[model samples]
Target: MINTGKQAQLAQLKDSNAQLLKRLTARESRLNRIGMGIDAASQEAFEAFADGINGIAQGVEKTLRNERDAEAEKLTNEATAARRSSTHTSSDTAIADIMQDVKGCIEEQYLAAEKNLQVLASILGFFVDVDAVLAGCISVKDTQIFIRRSILAELSAFDCIFAAYNKIPNGSQIAVQTAHSRNGVPRDYVEDHYTQRTTKGGLLISEACIIHDEAHGMDHAPGIYTDEQISKWKTIVDAVHARGGLFFNQIIALGRVADPNFLDAQLKGPSNDVYRDREVKEMSVDDIHRFVQHFKQAAVNAMHGASFDGVEIHGANGYLIDQFIQKQTNKRTDEYSAETLKLPKEILDAVVQAIGASKTGVRMSPFSAWQGMRGDYDPVDQFEPWVRHIVSTYKDLAYVHFVDPLAGSSQEDFRKSDYLKKIVRDAGITVVSNSDLTLEMANERASKYGEAVAFGKLFISNPDLPARARNGWPLNEDYDRTSFYGGTEKGYTDYPFYK
Candidate 1:
């Protein structure tokens, strides 16, 4: 049943916003004369904002003008859409809950918009009344309902699946399920996988691409080391760009994680650690310098040769860098063990020096024991100084990608990433979190904590995640955990978008 009182309130709010848009548009002619020091982009953005509000008002007016029966049908459809976004919600407050999501987003965007408005208006060499300018606008509470009833969760898609990398080749020509599995470089499939999940301004981080031949831990995983590999990857990246998505290649060196099955004498790490019966040759100082150069060159391969938007240093999840940071593994007495940050700083410096800070990012899972990063390892205590160093040293770097607790870890398991997030926040830098996240939780993090939330599994199943979320389309729940890793199209590109 429709809430008649709420419906009436929405109608009034719609009319108020319409008037507000009218007032805003009335100042358009002044853009030519005394527009002050506002840049062209700001003026255009304000106009677009007015246009958006006007469109919403126009939509509401058309719906409200319908007959009572039609109005009921519209309300039913709208509420049903909201229900689909939160499939778990079965209460009467679904609409109210949806408003909270929008209100959170509105507060963030409004404050930013407000700052720009004040900054531009105050530079006029005279007193300018911002309130008088937006006087016809509806109340915040009412506006939240208005916007929620229109646009839902389409804020950002910042997920990175470990399977987000390119596929395996026919190792030893083994027979496979799909023919796509047999061929090396599933270019079309890889492109489709990424392109399907992409939305304008949304970020998609690729699977850990190998930095060098010996850096690989698994068979047939993608690498950014060669010209052919870079060329093939460029096709995938170009497809993502064509769909208005931002693509980043997360580069990694497996270190001791390389198994005896895949790597030969080339296996290397900071210490002579044995992983899965594979002996890791202790990397000499010169060897360490070579890996640094490899990362720098891989970054160059990613951004320049492959045309990727950026490169993410895979410093977490027990990779080469994490191995060096681990106290149990880094048993060196030389300058390499000066601090736990020696290898990381060298690699970060080399990559940033090669590609520039704006195009480089780093991910750290200090609390995660995913790759032997266990101990009395206090994430805040151990990683805080490194985070501080990053903030002071690499100004204007892309972002610090932090992982929340891995699956099955409690909030206090290794300590929440809230402290690390605060460190990044205090530095006024962008902090992105990629892990298991729902739309509502993601919105809370992105809006409240200023962390860009990235969904991994949800994105694997929902390619049009942003659109499906906004319109409240049902998500596909048919996922195979076995097929979650590098495999055929069973759980890959074959997952259909919302029709």
Candidate 2:
């Protein structure tokens, strides 16, 4: 931040900063401050972080340079002599130990000062002469690692990753699990889990909820059809709303994929097919008509009864709607089988009619082979028309979330969602791209395609994921995969937050 018009002044400033950094890697460095300094925390860089430091006075610069050089030189000479002594530890080991301390300071606690645009934007592109500053303490390679674990790596990587899209929101998704209580009622702790992840102005899509009793997919999973179900869900919706967040419940019907003994009702799909050794009755035209009505009523129940901001039609992951859309699942010779998209489109029309286009969204996985589902024709040939049709028909559809081929199936090899990037953007609908996206990948997708990316597994352990990403905090990596499904609050709500 020390400004200079001439090369001599700039070189002098970098040298001064290098000396200061060397002092920080010593045994006596402090961690309880906003910026690096050997003594009590200095306001120099923080002021640069606040208002720009356009230029430095020559006399002050000279004084700082001389003091830092003398101190750093003395420390290095003493450290070298100690390394040669049999009674003392090697200087390299000591320096490495101290660097670890500094690294922890950056990773776990450096962002403790405050998080705001004025501060972040100013520091977004900060740089240092890495080799010169960290020369004696660590090698060039290790210095880069230290920087990557620092605040500069987080914000500087993308100048406006958050700033450009502050008003538009991105968020995490809660996948359905069998952890709730009996009768499909959401547990208070589960509701509390959602509340912990909710940030003001962020989007949250709930775990898949059954649309009706016949749509039951898993044991103890929540539903939106019944009075008790809606009331319980309202508790969660109110909490999310209070945090200024938008909550959408994903509504699904398992159809032939449902566990036959558990549904206690007839399993219906486009054909009488065997799934996981259980046979299902082929849906009649009348039966298809009824499920359409069921989906429509469920959407109404979500928005009106439960107060969800919208409903994401679960036409993905080889569920009921997805079954109808895929060629392998819909084998009927009746009118219902003539067009595979008919059932899903009818359901979409009903939901849009009830909830309006702006409050409706759809999630699909045309490339998924989960539950024995795959696309008609080629995968792209099969789903491109469907994507085009949906965006064209429902212009204001809230979003179309797609599980990338890589995340959804094994047979897809390394397929990319390249075909989808433009269609969703051209329609002006927000595209919520999901799957195993790291922080870097999410920012790339967001900038390239104007997407609102969603994270699932990462949020399982890091409850305050948005805050972590905002201030360059490391994500907690100790999630219990065993406890991710049906478990107590240990792995559910006890994940630690970085302070």
Candidate 1 — number of clashing residue pairs?
1
- Best candidate, TM-score-wise? 1
The weakest ten consecutive residues by lDDT in model 1 span 144-153
- What candidate 1 gets wrong by more than 4 Å, as runs, is 1-186, 338-340, 413-415
**Model 2: residues >4 Å from true position, as ranges?**
1-182, 338-340, 375-377, 407-416
Residue 77, model 2, lDDT = 76
Scored by lDDT, model 2 comes in at: 0.61
Tens-place lDDT digits, model 2, residues 335-434? 5562647888899999999997767778887667778877344666657767888988986676788877664455443343666646776665566677
Question: Cα lDDT for residue 19, model 1?
Answer: 68
TM-score of each: 0.66, 0.63
Separately for all candidates shown, the number of backbone clashes (residues 3 or more apart, or on different chains) is: 1, 0
